[model samples]
Target: MSRALFFRLSAPLAALGRSVLGLLAAIGRVTLYAFEALSHVFRPPFYPREFAAALLNVGWLSLPVVGLTALFTGGALALQIYAGGERFSAEAVVPQIVAIGIVRELGPVLVGLMIAARVTSSIAAEIATMRVTEQIDALVTLSTHPMKYLTAPRLLAGLLVVPALVAVGDVIGIYGGFLVSTGSLGFAPGSYIQNTWDFLTRADMISSLAKGAAFGFIATLMGCYHGMNSGRGAQGVGRATKASVEAAAVLILAANFLLTNIFFAA
Candidate 1:
């Protein structure tokens, strides 16, 4: 009985190990394919229509959620800053803190997460469905480059639109922080604006935009990778969607920390 139980447990454990190895190999293969697609980006036969549609879907449709998230985040941050600042009687620093926090960290990170949740899953699902339905095979048969037709557009669109979304998120977040500071925290509106302008420099804005671009690349790349490599059935499509979003979110966070360290290192 004891031997039988050990075999049963070890069998599943060995299977799990094999599954992990397979997953790593899959990731490696997908990475190479994505790199190839990227190298082909500068080549001809670009899909302007597909790129435009992706841009609209990834950027325009994402505005409302990004705006609301920024607003609440900024507002909460302002309140927290005020509470903490009261310890040192530095309540006057609310606007500056809010501005820096929003522009430097919250904006890019939040927008990235939003896109990962919205755009990554959408792209993965759409592409997986297309694959399951034989549309990708048809494209191949039509003498079209699948990399150019299917991947490049979405990739480029993400690169372009995510930065725009991040900028908008920064502005909305700052405004949110402003609202909470002036309204609930008893800060004078004029003084808050003054502090905000005084504290924010060009370098801060540049760093924010840089972070936005990096996050954008990670989000879209993960989406396209999982989508293009999705399996044969409905279950595969579902798995791809889940995997893409999770990977995008994790990569965004990791990239944020790395970018921050690089940007602000002493």
Candidate 2:
């Protein structure tokens, strides 16, 4: 190869290698952070107050958004399914399809993405601001572990509360479909309900909740991880917030695919 061609090819290869190394480093750091935070869950000096606050913030305050999103998504899903089913005169399958679609896929994924957008950004911004203002340092000085105090409570809350959110979202989403199906689509209420009930399996529910827990962990962990390692300044906080949301969303979708394959693949 000519000198110029060799240099050009090597430059791109070097850049690719650097990118791969950076990605691996990030993954390693996040894994260690997760383990360290979980370890604190079993240690002394537990903070009930922080844990309670986290539950309230991560679960209760999240309901309105989750409900609204699921509601609209379910309704839209019903309409689309009905339209599509018309081709084969399978419009009667709306109830079963809606139930399975919402429970198995839409409910968990939508709830996770919404939480990532709302909670993840909020957490990253808050923590990044704290780090910028030396609040994390203050916690360290007071004989408190930052990971135990700040990270553990939120992580635990996410693991516990997100599954509940997913359940609620599933119900609301199914109800939305019910409303659309019976009210406008001329589905008899009793038959529609019966069909929906009959179509859902225990495995479907389990997989949905499992996805919720995984997504919740990913969302909170990304926020905490990026916030802790953020650069210094207003720009740093903003960047951290953006990165946390993007990472949480992508990870949630990826996790959902993996969980779905595990749960349903034949």
Q: In model 1, where do residues sit more than 4 Å from their true spots?
A: 1-27
What digit string (tens of lDDT, one per residue) describes model 2 on residues 23-108? 99989988999999889988988999999998998899999999999999999999999999999999999999999999999999
TM-score of each: 0.90, 0.98
C-alpha root-mean-square deviation, each candidate? 2.9, 1.1
Backbone steric clashes in candidate 2, count: 0
TM-score of candidate 2 relative to the true fold: 0.98
RMSD of 1: 2.9
lDDT for each candidate structure: 0.90, 0.93
Best by lDDT: 2
Model 2: how far residue 127 lies from native, Å: 0.5
The candidate scoring highest on TM-score is 2
> How high a TM-score does candidate 1 get?
0.90
lDDT per residue for candidate 1 within 21-104, as digits (tens), equals: 998997788679778878767789888899889999999999999999999999999999999999999988889999999999
Model 2 spans > 4 angstroms off:
1-5
